[model samples]
Target: MLLSGHCLIVLERTVLAASPAEGCALLIGRRHAEALWVQRIWPCCNRWEPASERQRHFQLDPREQLLAQRWVRERGLQVLGAAHSHPSSPAVPSLSDRERSLGPTLLLIRSGLTDDPHPLRAWWLPEPAALPGPAPEALPLPLEAPLTGDLGE
Candidate 1:
């Protein structure tokens, strides 16, 4: 996937600011050929129950998701997928993440509160039925930078 320069910055700042809680956002963009180009970052609230688990888990607010879907539809864009931060773990998908993922979609994770070696990563989760067994395996995907646009919309 190719992220607009602005999207990347917004993602970084959002995740950084959400230190104690997991920051979440919806990726809005259009697909061309096999690549998804991110045009905007629609920030969302993490509404996981039991505030104590906020650090290790995140639930994207359903209301925000519905609103995002409507907003993107109006702009001829798609809700590509989602992004979230991992306060203390690496950027890779955790066991719960793999099991919870509704696949054939993109999932971006930002690890650590600070700039760790692998602060950010993306994964492609396949459709559950497509898997050979019960195990959920997420394939790593690249997060690329586009050639222009440093400011976000």
Candidate 2:
């Protein structure tokens, strides 16, 4: 997965703003050859009902996800990935997270609110599981940033 620097900043700010609640967003970009490059990050609400606590769980509203799908199509881009914050924990997927996950979607998890870049991690979930499986292994998704000496955006 590739994310531009601008989009990453926006994602961090959005996630931090949500604070104790799990913030979620749709990663938007297109596929080129074999890689996904993220061009936009669309922030959405947590919308998980009856959350006695939101520090560890999040449910993306169906409506917002559908809208995001439509927007992706209209923009001629694909849903490059999904992202969420992990409020009080690490960026690793929880047991519940692994059980509910669908494969082949790149997932970005931000563990804490710090501006330092150490809290984020990415994973690739393989899809169409015949049964619920163990947590998908984590991936080393590098933040897609412009290299030095490149022209400004």
- Top lDDT prediction, candidate number: 1
Candidate 2 lDDT over 3-85, as tens digits, reads 77778788888876788888888888988887778888889888877775666778777898899999989879888777889
Question: What TM-score would candidate 1 get against the native?
Answer: 0.84
Q: Estimate, for each residue in 41-137, the C-alpha lDDT of model 1 and write its tens digit.
A: 8898889889889898888899999999999989999988889999888887776776666777778889874667768777767775655445444
State residue 153's C-alpha deviation in candidate 1, in Å: 11
Candidate 1, superposed: residue stretches over 4 Å from native:
113-115, 130-153
The runs of at least 3 residues in candidate 2 whose Cα sits more than 4 Å from the true structure, single-residue gaps closed, are 113-117, 128-134, 147-153
Clashes of 1: 0
lDDT (C-alpha) at residue 139 in model 1:
43
- Write out the backbone clash pairs for model 1: none
